[model samples]
Target chain A: MRGLFKKRRLLMVVTALSMLVLAACGNSNNNSNPSASPSESSAAPATETASASASESAPIEKITLKALMHSSWLKGGMEAVLKDAVEKTGITLEIEKLPEGTDGDNLIKTRFATNDKPDLLFFYPAVKESDGLGKPEEQFVPQDDQPWMANFNKDVWIDAFASSGTFYAAPYGGSSMAVMIYNKKVFESLNLQIPTTMEEFWALSEAVSKAGKVPVYLSAKDAWTLQIPSLQSGAAQDNLQEITDNAYTNKGTMSDFTAKRQGITFLKDVVDKGYVNKDFLSDTYDNAQKALANGDAAMYPMATWVMTDISTKFPDQVNDIGSFLIPFNDTGKNMAGIFPPSAMYVVKGSKQEAAQKFVNYFESIETQNIYFGSEGGIPTIKGITNTQLTSAELDAQKLADEGKAGPVGVSPSSGIPQYVAGDYPAYLQDVVAGAKTPEQVQEAEQKELVKNAKAKDDPNFK
Target chain B: MLKRQYYRYSMLAPGFCIFLVFFVWPAVSNFFYAFTNLDATFKYTRLVGFDNFISIFEDSGSSIAFKNTFIFTVVTTISKVGLGFLLANFVNIKLRSTNFLRSALFFPVILSPIAVALAFTAIFHPSRGFLNVLLQSVHLDFLMQHWLTNRHIIMYSISFVETWKWTGLTVILFLAALQTIPKELTEAAKIDGATSWEQKRHIIFPLILPVVNTNIIISLIGGLKVFDIVYALTGGGPGNASNVINTMVYKSFSQGRNGEATAASLLLFVFILVLVSITNKYLNKDNRG
Candidate 1:
């Protein structure tokens, strides 16, 4: 009986060892497929382009470039552009979608850390350096010599993506500005004009509140939306970049910048005055859009992306939405804060060429029109006019033409810590909850800025 | 004889290899990472000793997470085990629909945590939630509360959801253990002039002490490692009111502070180990007595 048991155990051990070897082989095969396919496909495209030159009539293999995009970006006419690229260039894009916000940002970093980088990825290059990918110069393929780069709008690319005169990313879509989108019907009902100064804005708020409607819909629950009032405050500061730079380099504090400081103060003021929704803490950006569309709220201080979202959801109410720059100061000189579009970056990978080709086709005038038609905004490329521009777009563009607009928000390129921009809304939430005063928020922010700067090994912080 | 012994040990080789690779390797690397300043942005990694741990301890965010985690674990653990026992007893009573009732109770456990949290988000909406509407309709207006938004009650609210989803598991476990109790023993007690409550107190409770102890440990571990529910529901928001250690670790990792995030995770591991160990020791003593 003992020998029979031992024989059975020997047979089981041999079977287990064989199964383990098979599993190992299967895993190794699975691991190589992703990295191998990209290179194999990338090689085909290059040779096809070369062979087509040698023989005029030849078929090109459709190359699929892997890309990582936030799930929200698909709504911004990115899918149309992807389909257009495939139709025109025969280069397919296999996109891996991730959740947006902090969750998405961390996943992108993890991908890079694990050396599982996609051919292309979406990120705002202005703040890309301090983010997980490290310095953009080392991480991305420079697009300085690309034909599309020359046709791109110089001001935006230089201000937003270019660091030390080098471009690493191309704008995926047009620019958006942080502006106050108001319901024209609500304004007409209240008999209020578009406010151009802080005093007039407060007057309009009181008027709307008297009518028993929310004057301003503050979506503090989303947290990121809380930064709009403060970001809009940057419009009135002529030396906004300078002030941010000083704070970035540890030479000045956030409280030293008065205009931006007032933005958080305005959030608290609106809540205290009962001008915002009663459930501001519970309200989300989606809920804010509904309130604005239904004329339950007068104004929502948000980026122009809400226009696309609102118009898509409520087409009839689209015409009733009008926008103006946030009059955050009493001086009546508020410029609309210009926000750069989320750009497509070429990660240093085996499929850079195909990614560049897709970017080129995506920037062409015909494809851009499709993007702007569906998701209306200012085209970042030169000589491409969007005929279907919304009233909000025209108003923001008018501010830009009059030299009243400047860059808004702190970016890593400006020497500020990345988390200051990423987590500022959390502090604003505390401010909204009355857990921290604006001054206290600034003090806490300053301390965080120093700690992060030191972590990054910035000499000035030491 | 030597060859037979070798064959016996070789049977464990594959299983041991998988455990070593998947669990042990990552745990060991995480331990090493906790002692370094390794982050997403840094190209080179260097050791910073206990600075990551010290930083986590000093941060206000970590303190909030620790407090919230404590409340969440305790509330969920007690509620799940206690409610599970009652439900198990109720279902164990010979009924025609016992099998159907068991399936209905376990249904919530199979649903996705994210889906459940999202459905609960709408159900807990301040002005429009079904819970509040039902309360108002029943004329219990004073009992209606902001189920998700109130910072003070957010953890408890989340704990309620956790308990609701997982209590069925405990019920199933306790039910299985209860079935093993011989009918003869309970019948003898009944014949000796004992009431149902008396029989339960003397027979069922003592017999199922082991299951109850197991349920507590399972619930305790599950409560500590919770991430998806809290993340999907609140994202640790309305100003970090519902932040737990895992969510805090996620935020730190999001901010590229991998070292601090790993240190926080290590602390959580140690916390779970100590709590489970103490509970194990106490429960074993009870079982022995």
Candidate 2:
């Protein structure tokens, strides 16, 4: 009986080992097949023939590239537009729409880790920063430091993105930073003008509250949204990039001490004064968006994308939607900032020649126009213009032109460390809940910055 | 007889093989990965000597998550077990319409957690929610505080939802255990001139101790690994007030800190193992006594 039991245990162990090996093999198989798709593999033969003819001249071969991109990029049949462009150039294209969260990042990471990378990778700035070093500076570095980083204009950094030096992905769509979307009917009903100053904004919020409507519909449940007004406060607003840079590099004189205090104060005041729903923190982004659509709240701080999203989501109420930049310092400037150029990069170990050709084709003015026209993305190419933009888009452009716009100070994952983004939201939410003072929030933020700096500097620390 | 046993074992081999492949192997691999610096970016990783385990203690997020997880587990376990037992006893009494009452009690268990959480969110809404509206109707306006956002109250709010969802399962388990108790013991206690409460204390309670122990272990284990309901509801925030071990692991992994996330998972596994073992030993001893 003892011998029989021992034999059975050995069999169990063998079966377990075999299963693991099989599972690993199965994963590897799944990874490789998609890269070696029929169209892409077929293009390889024509490229080899072209290479043979130009042994002395190294001719650039016409090759197709497969790209994994975000669903946002594939809006309004943009993939089909790209497909048509690729066909015209004798280059085949295969694009896969990625799902949200770690699934997309993991898919890309898995491909790279397994040496089965795509020809062109559509890198989302959000996912890159999400998983990396917690600071914004470290988050901005492009994956593999691709060559296209050098071609982008540095001055656009003030309008769109944080870093002036590094470019990983090319910027596509430009969004207004920290704009408040108010119901036009509510403004008309209350006889209130669009408030441009901090004091006026608060007064307006108060009046809206007194009128028995939720003053601001903040989806505080997703902590990120709660920090928008606080992080964009007059003080933090004055030297947004500088503070972000300082926080990342652990250098530079911090500025806007009062502004940071005021920002936190405003957030706290809004919550304490009953301008926001008490259950705001428990609400989802979708719920908050729906609330705005249903006219449940007078205003919500969102990006320019909300205009397009609102128009698409609620066509009937789209006419009532209007936006103005959140008056963080009462500057009366309608433009907050521009996100850095979104672009594609070729992985390091990729078949470089084909990848480069694809990149050149993708960045061409014609391709840019197609992408812009299809997705309403602002093309990065110098001369490309989008003619079919909505009224909100036109207003946003005017704001950018008037020097009212600024770059995204910190992204969730990539441009700066998340501790900056992550901690600020909670502090603001506490202020809303009447738990913390604005001064306390600012002090706490500075302490967190110091803590993050210590952690980044210490290699021994996690 | 030996040949027949061998044939029966051979027939079970296919299922055993599948179990080994899907569950046993991955679990063993997860155990191994916990000891390495196996990040998402790197293909090859070196075996780091307890660095991940050491970090778990040092990180504030992990510590908070551990404490929150323990609190949630202990609170939910005791409430569900104790309340469920009382409920079960009441429902198990002779009744003309027992089946309908039992079904009504078990209804919450059948509802999807997301649906239940959404319903509760509506109920807990400060200005417009059902709970506050009811409070105001009854002239208790002072009690209406922000239920989901308040850090002090959020944990309990989450626990209430969990208890609401799971109390039914506990009740049913107890009811089943109650039915198995020999009627002779209860009758003997009654004949000895014991009161209803006394009879329950000595006879029914002692008889159901094993079942109570089993329910407590199950509920405690389930509570320790609670993820979906909390994830759908609080998402561990208004700050990190409601964050549990699984949510922390998710956030860490989402942030691309795979090594840290694995470490958190490993620590949670170790905690569950120790907790379940202690409970098992204590229960066995209690039953014997």
Candidate 3:
């Protein structure tokens, strides 16, 4: 009886193993069928032009394109655009949001590296060789031939990814410029004018502190925010073009770019002067905005997106907020720092027809109006003219129109690796906490640049 | 008889295949990748040999990570073991609230580390946190700290949270082992005119030495492998001041320096193996009883 029972149990185990192997084979068969359908449907449209009406009468074949986006890109009229694009085009977007900061960068890079690519990727226009996405020309399907390219404002929106003018991504959002989003009520109450030089800016800060309010609120907890003041100062420098070009390669160091280091020094000086809030390290961007709106703080150095964010969230205090460039030097000619529009790149050989159709619909003037109208900012596309600008928005635009705004920080052509560029905020935090001096931060950055340059097999470092 | 023996060995087939595919394959691949210049670019791959390991040793950040990891491990292991033993003894006593206290003490161990870290993030907030508020209310204002911001104390703050979360498990393990000791041994010590402290020291303490050894090793291994709490809390920052080896490995991987990250992970693997083996051998030496 024991021997018979053992035989029966062995038979059952063998049967279970056979079933598991069969199930694994069945899964692979199912996955291949969907990938083939996109190409079949794409071919059907071209061949069946005469029978287009009949094809339309039949059920519309829906294609779902997976889109990977940073959590930060989820804001700024993204929901409306995503929903509207699906409705207009037959492509359904399966959106996956990655975490902000270095974690998100790792996820996207790994996905690209492992060939676990999504159909669409929401990213910056610039593609660094070291950021894991080797070269945009090879990794992405170019959109230069798309019909929307004719309408795209080429003069205003420079395709930094396309050095050869072979566009691989499309601009789908408004640009953001770094400015000091301050409380006009506090400024007016203190009878202070906007400072044009470093000395004047300090005098104003000192005045605000005496009035029992925080002079400059630094949201140091969010490491990204720490680099804004320095980047804005760097943008205002007359030799910015030279600095970025030389600093990125092994040709120049941070010590040579005095303007860039001035920003870090400015941050250190603010902490030393006790002009910032006591809880700068723990204070987040959201809390800082609230403090600024509630009149607890006088000024906040941030980008233009906060203008619309503050206006929408604090409707009552909308008129009381304003923006201006941060004066890092005593030169009296500081310029606003502008970041290019965030873009969407199509992965090579994946749902290209559906992805392109969705991109075309998204870049239309009507859709652009819908986006910029809700999320107030400077539109990168040509036809959106009636955006309702906030007071702070107008102030930043005024700076840009007066030829006082230029590209800031690391541009795509800056040749600085994205990972190395990303470390600037962390280094600034080290400086803020008094763990490292500005010179040490510069030295640390120089070491990182050389190490990454060698890794990229750059001849300059050799 | 041979055919029946073959049938019996076939039972091991399914489990062995799974182990080979999942665990062994990845571990072997990790070892292989550690030697090459693998990165996110994936364009060129070649064996750079010990260069990846050499780079890790040279980097200043890696040194800081090693130092921070050491401090975190020491602080967490000691606190978890020490506090867990104290709590276990308290609940082991016969009292009306014994069951309730035991349940409450073990509850935190079951909580998610991410959720626990997030809760502590708010508690450690410098200005508006519950901790600072409580301190201010009690007129202990001077005791208030920049918990997550101050570079010097950030690792300790993270270690404290880790200790708080895992101590309950340690307590339960110690409790189970403590109960195994015969009550007659303590009672006999008491009859011999030994005080409570003396009874605990001579009888109860010596008896629970095995459990103590086990708890220390378990806590030590846990502290060495910690990643989630540190990542969720500070992200190894205030300028990498609170970085552990795992977070540094993550940062390296994120920066597309895959080879260096893999090398660091292998180093971490060997470090754990050597340390745990030595500790296990030393602790078990007195276990003949």
Candidate 4:
């Protein structure tokens, strides 16, 4: 009986150990799949892209696009478009929704590095060196000669992804990068019109400040908030393209970035003069709209996305909110900054003919109409009218139509590896705090750029 | 002898298979991959030897991150373990509400770190936050601060949240250790005319010294390797102000510098290994003594 008991005990131990081993092996398999999902997202089954495609589209040609998209595109009602495309084209979608912010960027890069290439890349086409998603000759191509290019909004496309005479990706929609949205009621009370030049903007802000209200409400605590006015302020440079070109081509240096500091200086001046909200540093993106709604501030430097947020949050103020250009230059065509919309890219060796066919058909006015009905932002496809639009979106759309919407943010492929384009906002934050002048940030950026160039083996370092 | 050896090997096979597949295989592959000049797409990859490791020191931001990580680990470990020990002693006293107090203290540990960090976000909000609002109501407005934004206080604010979330676990650990001490020992200490402090110092402290050592080692390891709380709270910013080695590893990986990220993670692994080894050595020595 004792010997039998000992053997049974050994069997139990082996059984438990085998279970542990199996569990560990299962967890290792889960590592290949990302578990990034926003709160509202449904938990998807862990299905292999190929297997899923084969099973669903077995009766058809099994055209599955393994897609990677940023969370915003998913949350911003891009599903309407994706579902519509699948229904129209019969091409099944295998989607990977990435986490918000730089986490998604890392995941996409990791997927690429691991040779796990998705067929369709639906991401915001950022040209910043760090946001190396849709760089020239990387995973995607220009595909400029495609017939679908004719339908894309020409002005916004040129501003957003086009650099070095190579278009980066297809922009689904675009907006004036820095639309200075304001409470028209406050403007009316102060007898202020939309400022169209540098002098007018400053004077208007000063007048609003004298009226015992915050002239501007910068949600600086949300660091991404500062990029709005800063990027638009760079539009003051008449030769902005030349400077950007020189920077990437190794001919530009820190000296050329001097003009880009004007907005930062302007912001510092406002903050120092007590014209900005005292609680601006603590005011979150969530509360900024509420503040504007309750008349806590007059103007905020925001994008059409903010405009969308405001209308969504406070539906009563849809008509009350108005937007204008950043007006960094008195004479430079009110240079509008347009952000690249979340766009799709076809993998190089993907079933190109089928992919091209799907992409081409998705661009048709009928498909875009169904897409635009649910989606906001300026329509990328020509002739898709944006209904229930705010004055801000309308103004931005007008700029897009006029070919005045300029590019915004650090060029993604500016090749100067050291100086982070995103760090410009941090410098702006310090500038407002009166800790460092814009020149100091520029100096640090210069040193870093030189180091980066040397490190990258760029010939421009000397 | 051969059959007995075969039986022994068979008994070991399951756990070895797990460690071999899950741990050894990936670790070996990762170690090999660390040397490669792996591009964004892995298309044109080659071995680049120690270049990835060299760049670890080459970047200035790396030093700041390492320093912040070290400081955060030390400060939070001390705060959690010290506070946890004090709370454990107080709760161990003969009182009616000691059970309730113990449960209340351990509540935060049971809650998710992300949830705790989110709650701290509201608590630390400079103007409208609970901390500042409470301060203002109490006429202590000067005590209010930009908790997560100001680079100076960002790490402490994050560490405070870290300590708050995990201190309960340490308290519970210490409490369990304290319960093991015989009541007669304390009664004898009291009869000998030993003061409360003296009783605690000589009798209680020495009796729970092993548990104390264990708690310290646990706290140290937990503090050094913390990620979710810091990631959720400050994200190592206002501008890399509260950055740790892990956040830097994340950023490097994001930028498609996989080789550099692997090196950064390896550096963290080495730091953890050294600290844990020292802790183990101390604990083993104490047990023997």
Candidate 5:
């Protein structure tokens, strides 16, 4: 009786194994088919096109492209936008968002370490070669070979990846302008106009304060939030080009953020005057949205990304928020500062052809117009304008039209520290907390940036 | 008999292979990477030997992390064990409420550490958080201070949260050990003119020494390797103020400097080993005697 039962179990196991093998084969066929379709279907272009359209717009083979990115990118209308993007690209997307900051970086590193890379990665643009690695191409494939390079805004796009003359990623939307998003209702309720200069802005803040509302929602709990006024000041520099050029060469100093420049000092002004949110140090990104939606804070300095979050959380106030560049200049001139975006990269040794095709489609003006607003940044494609502009984006567009906006980086070219606050966010936090004076913060930043340059074995390092 | 023995040896094979695959292999690989400049990209790696270790020491952040780790381990171990021992004595009494009290005390031990830390984050929020609100409500507004952001007290605030969660386990362990001590031994000590403290010192305490050793070693190891609480709560920040060794390791790892991260981790491993060894030896000196 036992032997008979064992025989039946063995038969069942064989059947399951056969089905598993069949399922595995089916999955491979699905992923590999898209790579072949573009070329194969091209030969039969007219007939294939007709057949594809007739077949309810479904591609001959369905494929899932694995994409990894920061968790924050998933918010706003990003899902609806990505769904439309994936439909357009003829491939489905399987997205995994890593935690923000260090956790995300570590998780990506582990994926790289195991050689279990995603096919498509939405990540910060950086390349580290310590002058020790023999050859860079052993790990990465450059976009110089990718066909879509011809369409990008050449000057801006080429430097989006590593500054090493080896481009490896696709540039989509990058910040060419940052704006201070405000509640229009609060402005109207308090009877105030958006100020155009730093002095007027402060005066406006004072007016907002007297009206019994938070003038500025400073979510200082997030260390990255401390970089805004400093980055704005970077944009205002007449010597911004010289500063960024020399920063990688170990010649950059904290004096780059001089008091006369009005970025960091502007933050200090707000802090000193108590124009910053009372619970600024404890309030988070989400809390700021609630505050803004409810008219608790009249103004917040953030990129366009906050628009979707506010709109989603408070659908009623979607049109109530307006945006404008922070007036950091003494003359109160409105100017916009651009920061880099976390871009999408085609992973080497994956379905490269399919990934690149999807990327090519995704970067087109039509696709990017939608993607950029979801990211709360401007499109990197030269002529692509975000069509679904929030009141804030329209304000940014006005600045862009005047040619008053320019791309700014903490270190734009050398990639020493990709983000403006890369090495000095903590020091900025120290300054904000009264633990360190601005001079002290500057000295510490100078020391750390130099250290970072050397650590990366940057060519410009002294 | 020989066939039965062969089957027994075969049964051990699966478990041994699991240990080899999961624990030994990764540990050995990590130790190897400690000597190499293997980054996240894995595009380039060179054996840099002691350079990685030297760099860790040279970085000022690592030193801060090391100091934070030591303070966290020492403070949490002493507090958890000491408080657990006292609470164990209180709850081990023959009373109905004590039975309920034991359950309530042990309840936190079952809750996730990350969940606890996250809750405490809101509790410790500077303005709108529960702690400050409660303080304001009671008109002790002067006592309201930044719990997680104040640089001076950030580590202690984290340590207190950690202690609050794990101290329950220690209490249970101590209570079990206390229960194992005979009522007769305590009664005899009391009849011989020993006070409650005297009875505990001479009778209950000596018998519970092994359990104390166990709790100290467990908590010391936990304290040394603490990661989730700090990661979820402060994230070693507002500028690395509450950074411990594990958080530092995570920072380096995220930066794709595998060698530096592994070197930091190896140092942490050695620190934990040394702590465990010292406590184990100190407590078992009586057994050796």
Candidate 6:
């Protein structure tokens, strides 16, 4: 009886295995069909045939490439644009979208360590040269070969990534621009105009406070949010070109960039004057967003991405939202500062032709307009218009075109420390929070920077 | 008999192999990584000897993080175990709606750490949060402050969240232990005119010591590795006021300072290992006695 039962079970297992194999085969067949309609398939084959002919005519054979991207960005539909471009170029792309936090970086690292490196890797634009392997000369190709980085100032973008005159990554999309998003209803109710200068900003903040409303919803608890506005305003106020140049040349100290100190002072003044809530430092991003949306606070310095979040959270107030560049000194620049490009890097050991083609396609104006517009991001490529821009984005774009605005790269305090070990942002937060003076913070940061520089030079030590 | 024994060993082999590969290998690698310069690139790894460790020693932030981590671990561990034991004792007794009370208590433990942190963040907000609003309504505004950002109170605030989340587990464990205690011993003590306090001290406490030790060790290990709550709550911010070891390690890793992160993690592991060993020795001695 036992043997009979076992035979029956064996038969069942074989049937299941056959079904699994059949299912696998079915999936592959479905994947190859690509088109939903017969007409679409018939139309697609002509393009595919032409592409194949072009490939055959070319002396160089096309190579397959793989890329890893963040899942959130992919969910926003940017992956389709990339895939379309790759398919057109006859490059087979194996794209993997990873979750946020350590998982993303860990997956990339694991793949790289196992000699299965992706052809292209999406990296935070702010990743410092020193954070990577050896000097870029020993790790990657020259910047001239990678043309996309040419838009940003060489000192800030190319040279920043270039160690010994080689570039590892091409700058792609920019981070969401930082600006003061205020409720238009609140402004009309308070009979206030948008502040145009730092002094005016403070005065307006005081007026808002006197009116019994939170002037600025600063979440110092989540320090990054607090730092963004400060950094933006500071960049607008400071001669970052000169500062960056000097820092790059090793002729100037990071302390020479005093606008950051001014930024912190502005935050401190806001806190001290009771313009912001007492619990501002303890508030999370969500809490601050809620406070702003629910009318607990009048204004907040947040990225353009907040527009979508606000619209989703408070559909009624979507039209009532207004944005302005965070003004610095009375410089009269309407644009606060543009976010530096978030970059896509080609791995050093990747097939160069395939990686270059992918990057080139990614940087093409059409691709930028299509992908960036759909994803609600400003395209880095100039002269491409995104018809899908919201009113706020259009305003920002107009401001950028009028030369009233400029693209400000990532803050040195955040970016540089990624390569070197130092608590630049944390120290600045302390200064803003009344824990440390600007001078004290600057001195501490300088010491750490010098120590890190020395550590980098220490060949015998490692 | 020999074949049966072989089958038993084979059955256990898969689980043991999994443990070795996933847990043991990573733990061992983390220890080795402490001595290398394995930054974000991971490709640029080089042996840096004790440079990362030396740097950690020199950095004031690291010292503060170490101090905060120890304080958080000790405070949260003790409070969680104590509160959990008390609640367990109360809930374990025969009562109407005991199951409901138990379920309610265990509910927070089942919640995602980030979600709990977010909920607590709202409750603890100084101006608009429910806690402060209640305080204001009761004319106790003076008592309310920025709970998560105030340097003086941030540690306690973080510890409170940890206590809130894990206290239920401790309570359940203690309740299970409490149930197994001899009814006869308590009855005898009561017959001899022992008060509740005296009986608890002599009979109940002694009987539950083993469970207490186990809870302490588990909570200690958990407390030592506390990351998500802090990450989602304050992110060890407002100038490293609430920086813990795990957050520090995370920051290092994010910034591509893999060597420093590994070193910090290794230090944390050693700290936990030493703590566990000490607790184990004490428990074993007590058992022998």
- Top-TM-score candidate index: 1
Which regions of candidate 1 are displaced past 4 Å?
A1-42, A49-56, A410-422, B41-44
TM-score of each: 0.93, 0.75, 0.93, 0.83, 0.83, 0.76
Candidate number achieving the greatest DockQ relative to the actual structure: 3
What is the TM-score (0 to 1) of candidate 6?
0.76
Q: For candidate 2, lDDT tens digit of each residue in B98-169?
A: 898799889999999989988897888777789889999999999987887777777788888999999999
User: In angstroms, how far off is A158's CA in candidate 1?
Assistant: 1.2
**Positional deviation of B81 in candidate 4, in angstroms?**
1.5
Candidate 6 lDDT tens digits, B1-289 = 7855755565555557658877999888888888876756654346878988888888778887888888999999899999998999999888998999999999999999999999988898777789889999999989988888788889999999999998999999999999999899999999999999999998888888888888998988998998999878877877888899998888776655677788988888888889899988998688556
DockQ of each: 0.53, 0.35, 0.60, 0.30, 0.35, 0.37
Give the range where candidate 2 chain A is weakest over 10 consecutive residues by summed lDDT: A132-141
Query: Count of backbone clashes for each model?
Result: 0, 31, 0, 4, 3, 1
Supply candidate 5's per-residue lDDT for A218: 81
Q: Candidate 1 residues B1-289, lDDT tens each?
A: 9976877677766767778888999999999989887777545357878988988887888789999999999999999999999999989988999989999989999999999999998899877889889999999999888888788799999999999999999999999999999999999998999999999898999999999899999999998998999999998887778899999998777766788888899999999999999999999899989
Per-residue alpha-carbon lDDT of model 5 for B71-98, expressed as tens digits? 8988899999999999998898889799
| Alpha-carbon deviation at B133 in model 5, angstroms | 1.9
What lDDT score belongs to each candidate, Candidate 1 first? Answer: 0.81, 0.65, 0.80, 0.70, 0.71, 0.69
Q: Compared to the true structure, candidate 1 yields what TM-score?
A: 0.93
How would you encode candidate 3's per-residue C-alpha lDDT over A356-397 as one tens digit per residue? 667887888888887876787788778786586888989999
Residues A1-462 of candidate 4 have per-residue lDDT tens digits of 697578768968887878986888665544433222212211222122234445765443435556787765664345676676666555777788888666777787767555456656776653433354434466565557777778876664565655444564666543435677888899998888887777887788899888887789988767678767766666555676667667655677655865567766767777877878877765767778887876778888888777667766787886788777767666665656667676666654334445555566666667667665664566667876644467778877787678766666445244334333335555566677665787776765665455444434456655
Better of 3 and 5 by DockQ: 3
For candidate 2, the docking band is acceptable
- What is candidate 4's CA lDDT for residue A221? 66
TM-score of chain B of each: 0.96, 0.93, 0.96, 0.93, 0.94, 0.92
The sequence of per-residue lDDT tens digits that candidate 4 reaches over residues B210-285 is 8778778887778777778888886666656777888888766654566667777777878889988987897779
Docking class of 4: acceptable
* Model 6 lDDT per residue over A374-458, tens place: 5555654566666345555555666666665555443344333222425666776786678887677767766565555544544
Fnat measured on candidate 2: 0.48
Sorted by lDDT, highest first, which candidate order results?
A: 1, 3, 5, 4, 6, 2
Interface RMSD of 6: 5.8
Candidate 1 lDDT over residue span A148-210, tens digit each: 866786765586777556788788777888888899999998789987787888888999989
